[model samples]
Target: MYRAGIDLGGTNIKAGIVDEQQHIIAEASVPTNVERPYQDIIRDMAELVKTLLKQKGIGETQLKSIGIGSPGTIDAVHGVVLYSNNFGWENVPLTEQLRQYFSCPIAVSNDANCAALGEVKAGAARHAKNAILLTLGTGVGGGIILDGKVFEGAHAGGAELGHTSLICGGEPCTCGRKGCVEAYVSATALIRDAKRAAQQYPESSLNAMCEGDLSHMNGKIPFDAAQDGDTAAEKVVNDYICYLGETITNFVNIFRPDIVLLSGGICNQGKKLTEPLETYIQDKCFGGSKAFIPKVACAVLGNKAGIIGAANLISGKER
Candidate 1:
């Protein structure tokens, strides 16, 4: 049987029909336009699923389940998005709303967790029963998988690894917390540090790369400058890596998963990012020599991970 996976984002709603092999056979997307009422968005999601099924010439009986990867704090047990700052949503019964249009076992989970599940099932760490994925995008998002299952904790509100504190009274975070891992390890954080460095060292190549516009500075600017042998850019890149290394070390020491995967734009750095991070984690993790040390790598699934993982939520079980 196949399953429908919906990746609900503030900008778009992506849905796909994923086969048991975890391949997307039919897929489509629609603008979320979250400014509209929540009901409209839910309706659009159902319609997208229907379109995918029709394109594949499949019927309801051929679909095993529907899974959604939604942002914010999700009460997966009830398929409710408790709160999502991105959507300004609160207490939306997403699963119940979708059921009105599609009759299938529905499951909803935090988008980051779904990405981790996707990686476990078909991407990086596919062979590992325990894995952790960190997505360094606008903010750092994390998903923890244990024993081949997503661990949502007791309230289905845990696994928020980004919010874990990294510094005391350091950079302020959008979450109203100071020195969060997200504040240091996210692409936002990298850009912030890069811009500051460029301003302080006007001679740095990063200034020219960003066209002297601080607002134009991005996560790649510093890395590009560092490759050109700019000391200031190198400092920014090194500092970002140091903070990320510390965060990964903390997670490794605590969970000891089989692998720690890094996702999002930072992964584009390839060995430049992963090599140092792997070294730092190895040097810092407790009992690294005697115990199993988790390997660090870049996640391969990219954007499709959430959709594929969400579709496989039922794991071949029938409703």
Candidate 2:
């Protein structure tokens, strides 16, 4: 039997047909074109899945289940998207709509959680029964997997690791909170701090790297300049590491999972990013060196994690 996974995003709707072995046998995608009506988006999603199955010459009955990774608050038990800022969607009957096209068990979950599940089923955390994944992109998004199953809390809005407060009342977050982990650990936050550093010291190499235009600065500029021994850039890089380190430490103290994975552009820094964080978590976590310190690594599946994980929503079982 095969399962279908759909990754619904603001820009695109992606679908895949995966075999029992967890490998994607076929895939299809369509531009979400968020400007259209919700019905249109759903139609596109349904069509994409149909196209993939057709391309593989697989019958509809061959698909044992279909899973969707949707953004925002999800009522997974009911297959509804409670809210999605990206599409201005609220209380959307996602699974109900899809069932009109495909007759199978459909599961809808937070995209972040699906990503975590994907990593566990086939990616970096495959060997670990419990793991955490933090994606530090435009905003910080994360998922918690406990005992080989996604933990959705009582309300299905749980495990929003990014929105958790990192500072009591520091930077404002997009979620209307003050000093969320997203406010400090996201790539946007890192770039914001880099631009500020560039403006503060006109003589800094960062200023030269961005060519005196702060808009040109990105998450990589600081790390690159720091490696070249630029004091201003080093300070910015160190500060980012400190904030991220402390944040991971706090999570470690709470979950103490088998491993913690970091995703997003900043992870491109490789060990330059994970090494320091490992050292910090080891030093500051509750048990210090005597306790089990989760290994920190970068997410390997990249964009595919969402699709693979979504499919596992039904096929996956708790260990």
Model 2 vs. true fold: TM: 0.97
**Which residue pairs clash within candidate 2?**
none
Evaluated at residue 85, the lDDT of candidate 2 is: 94
Report, for every candidate in turn, its global Cα lDDT versus the true structure: 0.90, 0.90
lDDT of 2 by residue, 181-269 (tens): 99999999999999899888898899999887889999999999999999999999999999999999988999999999998988899
Give per-model CA RMSD.
Answer: 1.7, 1.2
Error of 1 at 275 (Å): 0.9
Q: What is candidate 1's lDDT per residue for 1-319, written digit by digit as tens? A: 8989999998899998999888989889999999999999999999999988988899989999999999999998888999999999999999999999987899999999889999998899899878999999998889988888887777867999999999968999988989999999999999999998988999999999988898998888899899999999999999998999999989988899999999998888999999999888778888877877788999999878999878877662122
Pick by lDDT: which candidate is best? 2
TM, every model: 0.97, 0.97
Report lDDT (Cα) of residue 119, candidate 1: 92
Candidate 1 residue pairs that clash: none
